[model samples]
Target chain A: MDELIINSELHQYKIMIGNRIRYDINTLLPKTYSTILVITDDKVAEKYLSEVMSNLQAENIFTSIIPAGEQSKSFALFEKLHTEALTYGLDRESLIIALGGGVVGDLAGFVAATYMRGIDYIQMPTTILAHDSSVGGKVAINHQLGKNLIGSFYPPKAVLYDIDTLSTLPRSQVRSGYAELIKEGLIADEELFQSILSSDLMSLSQDQLHNHIRSGIKIKAAIVEADEKEKGMRKYLNLGHTLGHALETTLGYGVLTHGEAIGIGLLFSMYVSESVYTIKLPYEPLYRWLLNNNYPLFLEQLHVNDLITLMKTDKKTLNHHIQMVLLKNVGEPVIKEISDEDMSSYLKQFLRKLVIA
Target chain B: MDELIINSELHQYKIMIGNRIRYDINTLLPKTYSTILVITDDKVAEKYLSEVMSNLQAENIFTSIIPAGEQSKSFALFEKLHTEALTYGLDRESLIIALGGGVVGDLAGFVAATYMRGIDYIQMPTTILAHDSSVGGKVAINHQLGKNLIGSFYPPKAVLYDIDTLSTLPRSQVRSGYAELIKEGLIADEELFQSILSSDLMSLSQDQLHNHIRSGIKIKAAIVEADEKEKGMRKYLNLGHTLGHALETTLGYGVLTHGEAIGIGLLFSMYVSESVYTIKLPYEPLYRWLLNNNYPLFLEQLHVNDLITLMKTDKKTLNHHIQMVLLKNVGEPVIKEISDEDMSSYLKQFLRKLVIA
Candidate 1:
């Protein structure tokens, strides 16, 4: 029973992380609610919906299953969830349980965020990648042009991350989750970073996964607490997300798992840091890890000009300037505004370095 | 220009009111927005879209128009607006200008509320009914089961109310807008109630209309400030709304204007107060006024049982208990839980009294 409390400006809630946390769903939930609508994707619903439902002690509990993937976070799918909630007569007092990975959490959290203006929702993250998303209140859907292009910063009432659910995740997904895990270590904790870099990426015990996820969440939670509305410190969490989102969007969403796309973005950011910020980040080892994991870091398939256009159009870029997060060192993250010309030059250099590494 | 500032937990900004105030849209809006997406309806677009667009000093401005009426607040329409917004490339730095009545405000506000998790939205109210809807941060879209069934509490960055727009509104709409206006007075201000009752319901000068709207907004603003989340005193603003929403929903939305339905509901709530709270409510003048204005207080078309059922299912009700807000007198409101049986009896008695009055 590894439970941590998240204190946010909107509301403070518990993030229960353990192997079998979903078993305590009855006690974890509020004693009273008009209805409960559990929103999950097809993949998660097929695997764990019945188990979640069977564990629920309350009445008027309904499940809405969206199709599996990033497409589920579309405006249409977001609308479908609202229709389901309306059908269930889920009122303000009703609870929305987002029971899946990042897609389910982001999509369902968004539905809860705007359904009747906002309602209470809990996150039951079933993927390691959701360890980052489950903690931060930032939830959104995607537009055809961009990933997470449409959404809100509505936080969940609590996050219940069960490591047991990770057992069924594909190796790519575990790697995807590691993107954020490593992000936490890179921007905030040197010891955590070195420990994570030394650990086995292909296989790890549940305890290691738990520790990594917890450390990532702690770093994220503190940053979120400092700037819940993303007014300041929250940008550090987007350490790799600037180009990460652009790469994800340019390649078309869901082509690369979020963490994988971000893994490359993280490398690009560190590469930029070495040049733009004059910070000596050991880029070779991290670049090799991504390469060994079969991450497509090669830019031959993706045009630099096209990717730069996507970066300029990124939601994070204000005033049409790309502000990419860079590392001053292992424990120091800085946001630097990179011009397209400079970004293209850096991309050429970074890819050249990636080939050498 | 009559400018007043609203201080709320979400955010605060000025509510600018006057005739042809949209002329100042350039200086009034924040200079930093990358783009502006003006969301209006067919009717408002036909009349004032260009004026708003031309008034914009910013180069990147776009407009989206839905059909005019409550129908535009549907899930489908809401999704369409998101699509339009996505098509427009509206980003986090962009602004959403809701330029119509409450439908546009609610629908567009709900869209902006969730668009990229919310960007700054400015309420450019073109209807009198919007005087109530515009001021409060309560924005929503309707479900088939209920009005405002899906929405959130995202306040606009500012409200720009042009009284000139109200001049073109149909008499029915002006009357519809009065429901919330009268509600504000009835719940909070004895003097305002007396003055409104003394004035010609159908005829008023533009200045007089502005004063009533401003006064109504002031009362609503005070309540909203006290209970932004509607946890306590803000429920007072729903004085006529409990049965009002039920009556509106039961009547088939759009059949009766929001005010006409709430007029009947207000009469019913007063009757309930007389019985349940033993409050001395001056019911005759208001009932006579309703008759004079052709507000359908006639219960011949409505079934008491159906209305009761609707009330029981109202979003305001909790745990199947229909708690109706009752007034002890003008400026003294109380929320009293009315059982199904009692509400039905009161409906029967209230109709009998309306017929006699």
Candidate 2:
């Protein structure tokens, strides 16, 4: 297993990334903690929790499972976990192990952060999508009004990214997770962007995939280190999330995977970059490439004005102004305020042009 | 306004304690942030939100009010605040100002910590009881089965303790809050303990009472500084809290203020400490002192077994062992693992003794 140390302004934690690393938790977890409470979702608990449980061999390991999906990451579910943690006897010395994807990580990490005002927790990511979500100490739950509206910036003691579990993930989930990789490249890495574009979007060997995942994580770690709270440079990572969250909320969260919504949002941001940012880039070729790779742009179906209204609820929006991360060029992003008129006009042009294609 | 900077290994914050200090929020708050969101419970919001809003005159200032009670300090209420915040256009640059007592401070501070992966927030304490709750930054919500089962250790940007608002608090609430002062004295300050016992518990002059409030906060702040995450010294703050939470949960939270339940719990813990540690103290005097102060030591009403069962849900319990903080002697506390048999027998003796008196 390869280990990466992420040293951010708020906290520093170790991330273990490799195959079958979930069973090797003892190498990283603290020996003093007598018991562990592994929090997971119904979907993942049925599949992978027992394997993780046997590996830890905890004197008193407990499990609390909630339903799977963004909907389950609510205040009600959080309360249930809290009561369960308390009922099972979690103290300062007890560890919380989050054993699932991003939703599970965010929710369980939040439970750990708040349960008795913080305790140690380990992340055993069960999805390829979690590779991006599992890193960067951002833990939170969604409010009905907005995506990820309630949460904390609490890091885990260690992250066990067992790649072997990724084989169990659905194809759509894999594609969805890959969207964040594209986002990492769009913000910082020119070489990574080129690599993603050149390689087959699907059907990659394990070594090549791991290299790509590590590159994405490196870029994210650098951003988090620079600004753990997203006051400045960290906003770059929200390249597609501002619109992506709006789509997820407005279109209904369960309708699309987090990465899939972001994929569509990323395409819209490129168009914004092309028109409003006025950045010179190879846009036509990139658009054609996405189309070839089966990225359904969905421009013809979505309403522009309605989308802008939904975007207002995003955390990135400042003072009623809709702010977006627009690409100055490939591998270069800048936060820009988009006027409603300009955004609507741009969306109209893209819809007309894409429909004719 | 007296501004005290608390420098701890994990957290550092300024505590501004004085009268009518809300006016200084602009100067007291971090100059980096632009917007502010005032969070309060419905009771305090009705009385004081306008005053708070008028002082911190920002174009983007917004107010959110939740139902007032321990019941409101749940995931449901937290989600309400989260949704309200999003609706009000809160962003990373925004600040959340908690304008009520413990419930507001805990819930709002939690919302700030979680919203957008952590934002800045200030505690503008409106009630005298808040003097203890506002300072330490232990923000949380209660689950259905237990109190403070879900929470985080995110300190506020600054705590503003305005003495004027205490005038609006009912005598019952003020008396309820005084239990914490007695608790503070019991654990660490013999001088304060004697002074409180000698003074008129219900009728101390405002200026004289503020001094005690400040002293209690000072004691709490010092303990928090020594151990921000409750690894060691901070556990002393949980002196009455373990059994107190059980009493509050068992009796039903609204039936008693947090302080009242803790008051009863304190007596029980003292009895347990005297027996377990071979430390003898005058039980009659202690029981009489609590009665004179209007603290109801209803040993006959509550079942020992039920209280013990509820205590098992406390986060302080490790591996089914309830680690209770007991008074070795007044001003010295010892956290010891006690069996259900020991606690049950002690409760029976204490009840029998109270009946004879």
* Top of the candidates by lDDT: 1
Instruction: Report the lDDT tens digits of candidate 2 across residue range B105-128.
Output: 888888887887778888988876
The native-contact fractions of the candidates, in order shown, are: 0.69, 0.87
Listed per prediction, chain B TM-scores read: 0.96, 0.94
What's the residue-level lDDT of B250 in candidate 1? Answer: 75
What TM-score does chain A reach in every model?
A: 0.96, 0.94
lDDT of the structure predicted as candidate 1: 0.82
Which candidate has the top score in TM-score?
A: 2
Q: What is the C-alpha lDDT profile of model 1 across B11-91, one tens digit per residue?
A: 778888887888888888855576889999889898999888887866588889899888788878877888788777776
lDDT of 2 by residue, A226-319 (tens): 8876778888988888778877887887877888778867877887787775666656665665666666565437777788888777778777
Clashes of each: 6, 2
Taking chain A of model 1 alone, its TM-score versus the true chain A equals 0.96
For candidate 2, the chain B TM-score comes to: 0.94
- In model 2, the Cα lDDT at residue A208 comes to 71
Instruction: List the pairs of residues colliding in candidate 2.
Output: A114-B151, A151-B114
